[model samples]
Target: MASNRPAPEAPFIPAQRETETFGYGDHRTDEGPWEEWNPTEDSVRPVRGRHRVAKQRGGLARSSTVLGVGVIAAVGAGGMASAHTGKPPVSLSMPDLPSVGSLFDDSSASDAARATTPTLSKVGVTSADSDRSGNAGEALRNRIMAQAEQQQSKADSKATAAALADAEKQSAAAAAKAQKEAAAKAAAAKEKAEAAAKKKAEEERLAALAKEYKLPVVSYTITGTFGQPGSMWSSGYHTGLDFAAPTGTLIKAIHSGTITQAGWAGAYGYRTVLTLDDGTELWFCHQSSIGVSVGQKVSTGDVIGRVGATGNVTGPHLHLEVHPNGQATGIDPAPWLRDKGLNP
Candidate 1:
């Protein structure tokens, strides 16, 4: 009957099918005749004898695991970026796929680039620790150099001090030697001057003695010499030398002379006088006998009289007197005899 009822609906049944994904050699099952086939639980399966399960109720477990991993990676990247001062990361995803974190890359380096980084020691300084290490090494080097310089300076100073001391020593020695030589020279010169003065004095004395008159006294025993002090004389000293002898001793002329007087005089008894060529006079008193008379010439060794007791005498003596220029003056008989190379 073309009844007004709607066309009958086909009987409905769900095919026994399992959704799956394929990877590598894994694929879905395609078996039996496709035209007449009805899919049954026994008819369909994975080709690798595997089929997808419910995917843990819409794959929530896997999705949760992936989401957790991404969150951790993003946190790590954010922390690194904070320290590095680089750009922020972005998330990339394929169509109908889960997203993944893509971190920013350093611009200075590429995927193929390699770097040769320097060590902190060679880089001189970077962090606080490296800066301290570098500074310590530099300070040590500078101290070593300074110590070396100081040692060298000290050595130089010592050498200069030694040189100065040596120079001073040499100069002192030279000056001492010069002074010694000068002293020796002065001594020699003084000795030479003294010798010359003595020689001149001796020559003058000899000349005066040669120009003097000869002795006038005759041979007699000399009792008193010239320059003898006498209390009986009017002068302080005796002017004539006294000769005490026997009354008969020969009286000889002391030098070449001429008889001046032979007579008795007051205070001079029995006197014989002689005169020299230089006007010198010799008196021989107390003569026992007068051999030569007045105005008689006599040589130096001629007999003039004999010894006798003269005036103002205690015994027989020939009083011999010498006078320069017959002036009633007398000189020393010792010196007069020494001038003729004879000792009185």
Candidate 2:
């Protein structure tokens, strides 16, 4: 059997037509006015204002747009990148201030801060470990200084201890010296006491020996004491007993004695000395005149002198002194006078 089918339509329409038109002032031409005539379906194509072209990607144009987009994306990513690797975006945030600017001008503060300014580290640069290390260094320095001071203090304490020890030694020595001195003083005082006791015993023996003698001067009133302190005599104290009596009074011999010294002495004026047979001497002083002469043989009851105020005499008085032998010292006449039955 036969089929009346022309050849099948091709995959693409082969016929293509391009037309151009000119317009002026609202005038137009229609399809009936033929400038050139040819009739063929193959030659004419449907007039195309809107055509459904086969949508195919353009390689050059698509590549160009892709490169441009790639450039723009790269720029945007670069602008939004983080300042630090782990930080937020740099371009998306405000910039931070420099840390050193915080304390750049410290002179605006007080003097205490200024004194410590050199020790301060730059702002934001110091780490915790660095601060700790700095503190440790300071502590070490302080410890060194403190140790030095301790050593010095120990040395000073030792010196002071030595001084105190020396002082104690000196004090001990002084105490020993004082103790020795006190012992010496006690011994001296004991010796003095013994001497005074011996002298008192000797005086008692002499008083017993004087019991046999009689008083030489008679009818006399004792005016001055034997040891009265006065300047009338050369010595400060009176050397003999004073007897107040009338002038031209009969002077008697104390014992049977010979006249030994009879002269005008200075303080004891017109003195007469009589030596007894027992080697005792008696001085009769401040006489008006002496009846005896030196080496004159006289006995008891013989007149030796008259009582009067002679040379260096404050009154009419006789200074009588008894001496054992020709010695210069005179004994206390009161006891001897008492043995003679007279109170002086």
Considering every candidate listed, which one attains the maximal lDDT? Answer: 2
Q: What does the lDDT come to for candidate 2?
A: 0.64
Off by over 4 Å in 1: 1-220
**Best-performing candidate as measured by TM-score:** 1
Q: After superposition, how far is residue 4 of candidate 2 from its true place, in Å?
A: 99
Cα RMSDs, all models: 22.7, 26.9
- lDDT tens per residue, model 1, 223-257: 88788897876687777777776778888787777
Relative to the true structure, candidate 2 reaches a TM of 0.37
Kindly report which residue stretches of model 2 are placed more than 4 angstroms away from their true locations once superposed: 1-213, 340-342
